[model samples]
Target chain A: MTINPYHDKRLQWVAYAIFFALLALVPILLDDAFLLNQLSTFGVYGILALSLSLCWGFGGILNLGQGIAFGLGAYGMAMTMQMQSQDIDTNPIPPFMLNNALESLPMIWEPFWNTGTGIFLAVAIPTLYCLIFGALMFQARVSGPFFAIMTLAMLSAFYTVFIDLQPYTNGVNGISPPMPLEVGSLVVDPYSTTSYWIVYAVLLLSTVVAKLLTQSKFGLIVRAQNNDPERVRFLGYNVAVYETLIYAISGCMAALAGMCFTFLTQYVSPSQFDVGFSISIVIWAAIGGRGSLLWAIMGAFIVQGAQSYLGDEFLNTWILILGFFFILVVRFLPGGLAGLVELILGKLPNMSKQQKSPGEKPVDKASLKEA
Target chain B: MAGVLEIQNLQKNFDAVKVINDFSMDVIELTLCCLVGPNGAGKTTTMDLITGRQKPTSGSVTFRGHVITGENEQMIARRGLGRKFQIPAVFRELTVRQNLEVAYSHEVNALKNIFSFSSRQCDARIDEVAEQVGLQERLAVIAGTLSHGETQWLEIGMVLMQDPALLLLDEPVAGMTEQEIEKTADILNTMKKTKTLIVVEHDMGFVREIADIVTVMHMGSLLAQGTIQEIETNQQVRDVYLGTEDH
Candidate 1:
């Protein structure tokens, strides 16, 4: 079989080169720390959208509660940072633990004291959660718009749980480390160049991971099932297993994004757990053209950059503008921005000349059958 | 040796309507069996039951001696049972060769399917299946872009890629040109020498071209089982299925 056109290696590498080159240009152009921090935030959002695209766009699973995994990862990072801030001896307790008047650290909080374990939990917890949750839902054959609602419902439940668990979660106010991250001899100042580079590295790593997955044999089945799952099943594929594995993988990506987001923002709040955040993640992917990884990442940057720029002056109007813009995009560019580019490339004379033969006869079956 | 397929006292009911009632049939190995019947005769339903798309109301479907009545479709399919739908259900977005590669059942493990790339042997086998179905030229073309006849061949090629022991094809050549029909008949005729196939078709000419054993069904039950010529002369099959023009 010829290589899938979607996985065109040369085009993918060029896109990657352009993306990283643009990212490299960012720090050089913008020397201001605040602006650099904002760019880093957008980078985190790009990872989030990329993760959503993997599941919803490529895998054909609309997980409206992707924020649940994101929120969990963020919480994991925030909790670890907070545990690091606490004294180990006379008052060996996290400040949030003191908020609920606890003298001793909880057993769960002990694991986050080590930054390595904390990072592991950040990615691992959400991955495990998705494995269990996705297995149950997919095995039960829950999918489509119904699957979306189920995920949203689950997000609401997790939100409630996070809010009610005041001792562990710090209630609705959430958890933020009182001090800059200090691991023995090294102190990671949240606003330092080190923090920016760390977040940047993580974002790049997340993108690479996502790219490898979508290009793998597993990714082939994902795209196939996205078209027709019944056909895949009849071909002897375990549809549930395929969906579950992809869902969990997607969750891991989101968790990585969340960990970086928490590191950049230095806080995890209840707002991150909202269903709207998850939906917004989906919209970001849609804006970029969910079908392509690079486009989805760029989509997040464009949409979030616009939101941040206009958000101050227009406040409430900013959201309405985004909604209107998304509607316009859906109407005008069904394949998103990347699809529009593909459409333009398809129309060019040279491309058109080469495509005319195969394009004219074979794809005309619908009209032919009508006659 | 026992028959490759043995369906004993098989019954299927959808809600209150009994579609297949007390149907029993056995086809020996490497046979091209054509099942002919009018509408609502449970011809497709029997295929579905054998392929585990539907649960039998009663009785067992034995493939190679193992009872596989209520197993899931994927499980049955992995056990070398392949089926082509009445409507050509192919991965429309994928290329024709990719369709065969996806259905190629050598590496059926879910984990292996994800991490592993298609082997050279798999590619060679796919090419062979494509050539067999006269789709070698259209291998790189997207399946959805293929003509109706081509899509039908692609689906058949997909089933053939698995090298299934028992293949259930529903209307193998319903909407094909005369040339395409002849090619399809030639393909099926060659395939039956090595594989067992039960084809359900309304096209009598295509059936006569390929069928060695013809079984006639009427009202969810078998009416007659014999050589195509024998069934053509059977009064009961002629009255219930074929009109009197066939002498």
Candidate 2:
């Protein structure tokens, strides 16, 4: 029988179906709550990795402050849940405020205690931050190393501010919400396996939404802008607007991931938003392939799963390995593992039609010389 | 027709070096003008000043009677002026069809872009433009994979999709083959029927074929402006071209 290389959509679907089937069986087979929780953590990381991919991969934005946005969302939910447990009006100050502090809670922290306000702020704060950052950087035509430095500086600034604001943020110790969330008569025991499933559902929905957006016309513009901003601008596009929009969207998605993270850990701390987390998320995207959304999720899973199995003794060493992996992929495998898979598949004897010709060369040598 | 582009004493300086000094030009209706000069003769700077890519040190540029002296690049572009860079700027990862679609200005929102639909008008127009540029066969091909000549054509096709009133092209056929150069001349010739075009190039052969009038520049100042034959025999032009040879 002749193999139809053009009809590989079936193979693609089957691969995804098998992967999900394996994931669904994990909770049933392992039965170990700790393992299940680790898997849930991986799901949160996957969401974050996917979000970063949208900005960095598609938009060509080297955002190093993604963890700050994620922390904002996680802390936003944690604060609201804390207020709910204390029987206080979900206002700025809980009724138990007198016990912890002599005066009122800060005004900015007030909106975060209400559930609706908390959810809104979870997505809003990061989006606003990214919008402002993007507006300044893109308008100034900052790119390459300058763009990377600006993002790193922003990340460092957010980290320092969170660490210094001990009174409101609870400083390095971080804030943890109580178990079994009680909102009015409703109690949500997040420790239950059902809560884990809910988090998974959110992850799947957000992934689908992100996938749709990446394939859309706006996504096309973002990708184009990445390759050539000047051309997009010449086409009468406000390149800054597109960059800002992508930043905001990625920020909101990161924030949503943080919300899911808070439900899993019931904690929000400065350490969670540190530069280390930011680097780890980037590593996830890089390992997956810079521009491929599916690869980003896979990268998160592979990295987090390996870390969980290997324990903390191997965790520090993992960073070194990841750094080497990044260098290797950037140098040898420009497309990462997914790109490698495609290459290997193309080389298969039966997949001749799907293969790209080997002799193809770059077209604009003179343009590069002029630049 | 009313003056679509009017420049008054446009001057630009880089540190102590004056790149464009007291440069002035007026473009009326659908006319093709070529700006020719030696390397570092401020041809690119002149185009930059008109397109709002580089702000002039001192000068005024009016487009469509609107004083666009200090407008931003995007605003200037939106005001019915299109620019094609000397470098063939294109989205390498996208297909030719997708590149044109993104360049088409039907929807401009960033948030709603993902759910937006391309109109049938957009598809038909893309096809028409691609066909005009002889790139219809390569519509599905990735733009980065195109030949140098093809990429230049694609960039021009992208600009054509915008359907601007004024077009600024810098060395549109810099590295193209002779045949490709002929095709580019034909494309520009066809476009001049409906659009005012200002092209900056060093290839006198190509310029002479398509230019309605040629402007010559030396040391950042306009040396002469007239038909190609008029400027070629001008004493000062001959002196400048010959004087540099003795050095």
Candidate 3:
């Protein structure tokens, strides 16, 4: 058996176990209901960031429309919850329908009322969208800048469609939960801390699954495809199929995260799935390092945690700071925090000796070229 | 058992320039045919046409007595035709073993590939090919980190894993140390026992070492076809190759 040092399955499982344990203890350590709620939201964002990493990092696809998939999932769950709350016999519609002069709920929104159907739609819709989009783009061999532009176009189009479909989607005002969910005499409030922790637990499990997928044989293909897709194709593998699979998987993951987000916020609005959210997910993946799933989740938690703790004071400057950070990290720290950690660990012995040297000569350009 | 490759009136044109004008060749089973030509001779394009990478203007590429002219690359590959690009085209991010495993993945069956059982036989074959290519020691090393010579070997190893009846290698040893080139020649010689090998290479010394027959191409047409010494002495072949005395 050939021993591969780069990917160790046992080490990965151990790491995931540690992560799960730590997340399970968050409610215990924090103890504050509001902080726990924020943590739950952070968990949702972490899942989104991890999904973005899987697509962009491993698959070499720049998905600028991830928020669109998330919105689909969130709205799917929200619409179903809203319809169930209304308790209308034939066509269960929200009160907003009467105000808009609509007599009954649309036929399309009926499937979402059932929990199984809602969850299925939450995964299926985004996956189907990505499958169609990926097939078209990959078959056309649209990559790099063209791929980015195409995804951005899709994001804007989805945003417009969501904002325009007022009768079904409620437009920009979005949809909110009418009441707490009652599952066979069990009442579960979305706003409750216990409910938030449940969402957090789901996030942790999803992240673990994502991490495992990355380390599998399928994951290796994805990583290799990103580095040199032509080579993968020449190896008798279908490069387009690999890309499409990852794209759909990433879309499903984003949708799952959005489902959690609906529970945390109890609302699904157009603004939540706008370009801002899409770009923010990219930022999280970038700060975490594109290669590692753990780093991406950490990047999400740190960035969101800082934003939440800093409050409204830093809200105005957050975008600017994030933009600058993106530029700085891409320029100086190519691997983000993960790369920095590796560098620091590498120089542990020389750190004390080189403490006095403030600035050294720049790294050799030729060596960088070789890498 | 039959004609491994039969190209009948293969025609290809790039806009106005007519490259590969009515080119044809017949390669029998288990024969090592070396394709030698100067730059722009369309040797690579010939392999591309055979492997279904590029559609010919007018031609028929029959592999194992079956027409595969317009079949997709993956489909052609699954039909026991493996190709190596001019550049070493191995998955750089993956280890040598992982690269071979992916190359040896199950055939493209729409439904079977979705829910296929892992093939232990394929794993054994990968190990066998790794040993053949002298990459057994470097099986765990990332292909991107390998030396240029090792990368070429890794590419050849990937092709070997496909278990193809006919192998098309393009510039298999373009940039290699003398020892590495010699090793590649030895591997090719060993490979010719079971597979029909068509090598497009410029290294005449290496070509002379393993090729059973030499086919000299000039400006996208066959200049000469014979044994190594026969082509080496042919006046027309000399004129096309600039009469390089190294061979």
Candidate 4:
């Protein structure tokens, strides 16, 4: 029997609703401050995974320097909060500036003092960096594994720069506001319910935005490029522009997630831009299912939750266990958790058929079965 | 009829191996021209050069009396040059309707494309292209699930959606069944009224069926250009191309 395509679409939306509903229940069930903080981290990382899914999963551009965007966002917001804590009458200089024995406030740090400017810079900085980087790289036709390597190198460079600039950036220790986040008169504590709600709101909004983007014409074109970029070019789409735009969007989303992370954790650090963290972000997306944004986000939550559990009980062996699981998932369920669900539900077509891309020889079903 | 596409002395070399050597052709408006050549005769490369998929070492490609030589593939496509690859290059994961929808150029703005999608008018256009390609019933089917012949037709439909002035097809009916080939021929024949087509094919019979004029190439150079009968009767073409086919 032919499945109604609309029914499948409805079913997907239902899955999304259930996922969101479960996320909503997390706060209600966990009254503990530590658990709420942990849950907030999961929410933030979910957005990060979603960002990766948008770039690598759909656009076929692997950005291993995603943390650079995230770090920039966190720092942008952190600087604003730090400047906010400055006394207008007695002492204008922030604690970090005074600690560095700066005679005057740095002109470079002035713009981020405004809440609006800080938020704008948080999103704009990464978006602009990605646009410039993507324009140069894609124009040169540097993509796939080469792009990944370039991004990784750039991330390492960004980390070193952050570390070397100790006076300005606070070096390896990172930037943290001395006071709570203040919106006009209300003080938003990092561990408070209000802070948790802020992260949740952004997470929910990002999820919806991501869903809409992937369903749009632009998303289809990006996915099309992933399969055959030359074909997209022949179809009247500037593949480089599409790839660049998607990469930039991913960067912006990563920035937003980073801002959320800073709001929850009350800190920003150079360690976030490390190559290992970038790889971990990729793993979250890989584990969930890069093919779908929602799956990627869920994958982040699942992996992080597992990490917390493993870290609490078996700190040393958690890494080993996760590594084993990653290998199994990569080998057996290449599509990740979402793909496994898709398989069980018979949503996907024959594996061999789906694998048989243009110009590729189709695998023999008989041989596959026998093997 | 006026010439819609003119390729003059097009030369392309991959390192030392010359793919298209001083190849030239004038494709008249609203004509189905078949490009027939042996296995490494640079027929596809010629199409690539014209469509701007591959940059020529030395050549000039003029579309409607304007020099489009060395233009990017997307730029050439925007100039009304639509090309279908040797492999069925439809977005396999997308539905048949979506395949045509993406090919349609109603909303060219990438940013706007992200927000507001194609209008209801595009649906009607997609239906028309689907009908033309005989994939109307398979509109809901994913391109990946379609048979090889259907995938070929879906790609042809995608090209039609663009309403291109010049359509270059590379081995469109390569692995099609006889029925599918006849259907494709019918589709091409219908399109011939409004579009200029340069179809590269190995099947001489299919060429004879749809081609108004045929060009035969050998060793990256034009060997013959004439009617199907003229090509079959030409002694040089027979010796270089059809002569070896008996084996």
C-alpha TM-score for every candidate: 0.94, 0.90, 0.92, 0.92
Better of 1 and 2 by lDDT: 1
Model 4: per-residue lDDT, tens digit, A254-333?
Answer: 99888878877778899989898999898999898887778788889999998887677988888788888889989998
In the predicted model 1, the residue pairs found to clash are A218-B114
Pick the winner on DockQ between candidates 2 and 4. Answer: 2
Sort by DockQ, best first: what order?
Answer: 1, 2, 4, 3
Chain A TM-score vs. truth, each candidate:
0.90, 0.85, 0.89, 0.89
Candidate 2: docking tier: medium
lDDT of 2 by residue, A1-371 (tens): 23333223344334444455666776677777766777888888988998998899888888787887898888777877776655444444543444457377777766755777777777787778888888998888897668878887888887788778766777777777765555556555566576567667767776667666776778888888899888787777888888888888888888888887887788788876788889889888887776767677788998787777764777578668768888998898876666665676566675455443111111112222554
- The 10-residue segment of model 3 chain A with minimum total lDDT is A356-365
Better of 1 and 4 by DockQ: 1
Candidate 2 positional error at B189, Å: 1.9
**What DockQ, between 0 and 1, does each candidate earn?**
0.56, 0.55, 0.40, 0.49
Best candidate per TM-score, number?
1
**C-alpha local distance difference test of each model:** 0.83, 0.78, 0.78, 0.83
Write one digit per residue (lDDT tens) for candidate 1, span A1-371.
44443445444655576567668777777778888888888888988888888898889899999998999999998888887766677667876768798878888888887988987998899999999999999888888998999999999999999999888888898988776666667776666676667767877887777777776667777888888888788878888999999999889988888887887788888888887898889889888888777778888999999888878889988888889878977899866877766675467564442222211221222333654
Off by over 4 Å in 3: A1-5, A184-186, A348-371, B107-123, B242-247
**Of candidates 4 and 1, the better by TM-score:** 1
Model 3 complex DockQ against the native = 0.40
Alpha carbon lDDT at A24, candidate 4: 82
- The DockQ-derived docking category for candidate 3 is acceptable
Which prediction has more favorable TM-score, 1 or 3?
Answer: 1
**Fnat for every candidate:** 0.68, 0.77, 0.29, 0.62
